[model samples]
Target: MTQTAPSYVLGSSEQEIARLDGQAASIEAATRLLLRAAGIGPGMRVLDLGTGLGHVAGLVAELVGPGGQVVGLDTSARLLDVARERARDRPQVTFVEGDVRSWRDAEPFDVVVGRLILFHLHDAGAALRHQRTALRPGGLMLVLDFDLGSSRADPPVPLVTQALGWVDAAFRSAGANPTIGTRLAPLLAGAGLVDVQTFGVQGYLAPDDPRGPALLGGVVRAVAPQIMALGLATAEQIGIETLAERIDAATRATGSVVLPPALAGAWGRRAL
Candidate 1:
């Protein structure tokens, strides 16, 4: 059984980068809280995988302070440029171009972070095992990903529900795991990390807030090309242009806040 692995559905494009930056605004605080709780602090050498627009990497830089070093690695050199520009003020933060599964450093990291990157991987457990090798003994490893199955519009907006399903289907078709969050503890343990533990961070975007709908719509928009190419959806069906407006309208009508998938954090430490 040669099952083809999933590809990166959300591509690296100017538009996609902008949308990601917009989405990052809403989730930064939550991510910071998770990183802090994960015990990332000053003097730690941290490796941030799939750094994207460098949101999480910036946060880690702040947490680690001037005493620590943060290296953000991504396959897209374009993204690495964005990350570098954004991190210019932070001397301790650096951006490197590489793949998470194969990139290595002679100097081991005190912590390894894989945020929103697990689902994109074909063999996430194997990837974790490889990453674990880069961690120093007793190094902390953090895996944060979205449990998108939990995302929905309160009062059950049909359109909202349908929209969620569309994203899930597209992701699944791409071979990504939209709901891998809740099942991370065992994955970490299986990767040979000890003291495996898990946590969840939830963010509620008020009914009137545009961020929630924007976040949801942005994802669909980013993956629309791939979605259409895969025959999982069509552009007209996705309504690429006004998707956010419609989602916001529906959520506002219900007076129910929008919940964008729970941020599940699973972490463990390498053997001491």
Candidate 2:
């Protein structure tokens, strides 16, 4: 008998595009670090797990160049639509709608990569084990995720700190890990991967950073429903309509900066 696979809790909606747009810069920065850490280069076949908007896949496609191929897989058709649009000019990259846990193919790839996708899984280790089968011996697997609990702001912004707690609670309530970043190496090792390594990246929002508030606000608004359902906040407190402006105002008023969650990247090679 076949076992059922878990689904992605946060869906692919217009909201996903908004989130991706808001975090584009930071994502690009992390992408560079992840690709370099995994030693991705030209002519290498890559599998992008939980491809989402496919922005990362586009980056990998460029690095893999014309001779290589990129297969981006995600569970959300909505996201795959956006991904396709994002990659319309790049024939080397292809997006498919599929669950990472159940996805398999006869051909193996040189590299498998994902960002901010692991923590959302019910069983990330199990998914890694499955994805590993799609990798050739000694192929690389790189994942970038977050440790929300380690998030901090200098000079202490009470509201920002409190907001993170709500975010963590909501994620946990939805059966996701808010702090899965720091655990990836052990997860990889347990999955039978070799030479596991982990790295950390901090996302800082300067007091005068133009996009700082918008990014944080977009995230707050996007997750407001989950926050409310988890009883972490009430509708009035969530204030979806005004939350973004209010957060922007509050940070400016206090002369404080916002620090997004600390991100962590982990990589390991498929055992030979």
Candidate 3:
């Protein structure tokens, strides 16, 4: 089978790994809610796709407890190394370097999940169709992604809007879908998963919310190279050093509610 190479717009730098850690932290509560609803529990094995920094994998380990197993799959060995070190205390979690599209094993998992990954794929449904085979009977398949278009200030913050547009365009130029969150349910259904269901969560960030601004700024920094390469913006315009501070300032001055992208989640069970 012909394979498509990884085309993540965010380069796999150590800085990017750290950025992912912040992103995961910002979305931790939403993720936990989704995983619980997906029925991840004791003794269940899970496959965490594109498991950067192993954040989601570690969460699965917690949900499944000591009897459960979590294998974090990624193509970047460097990111996996960081995932390993961070998840060192969780004996149930392990990291491996491989593409979920083709990697398989004799032992199937009770669930296969991914966060912020479907948007990076050229054909998410097609990929999931094959990857789902690694699931045991009645296993769950869950995916969570961002609806970038839904992000906005309650009273309209221009700086936040412009910055978000820049990040969205960068993903578009790289042939990735930054706004695929709403399509998640249909994508899973197309992948042949049965009993599909959908749920979503979005953040309402206060001016003092450190995690929200930090994630936004970190994403901008991580994708700045793409933004520049695609001629979306110049370095001076981005002003990586103070972007987060400026966003905080804008939100505080207006007392506007900052809404980061909504995380859309979908899951379905394989036929028994």
What 10-residue stretch in candidate 2 is worst by lDDT?
Answer: 1-10
Off by over 4 Å in 1: 1-6, 230-233
Candidate 2 deviant stretches above 4 angstroms: 1-7
- Between which residue pairs do clashes occur in model 1? none
Q: Write the per-residue lDDT of candidate 3 for residues 1-272, one digit (tens) a residue.
A: 24476577887776876777677888899999999988888888899998988889988898889998999998888888888998888988988888877788789888999999889888887779988899888999999999999888767778788889889988888878989999999999998899999989999988666655677788899889888887878999999999989888887888878888899899999889
Residue pairs with clashing backbones, model 2: none
Worst 10 residues of 1 by lDDT: 1-10
lDDT of each: 0.86, 0.80, 0.86
lDDT, residue 49, candidate 1: 90
Provide the TM-score for each candidate, comma-separated: 0.94, 0.93, 0.95
TM-score rank order: 3, 1, 2
Task: Please give the clash total of every predicted structure, in order.
Answer: 0, 0, 0
> Which model, 1 or 2, shows the larger lDDT?
1
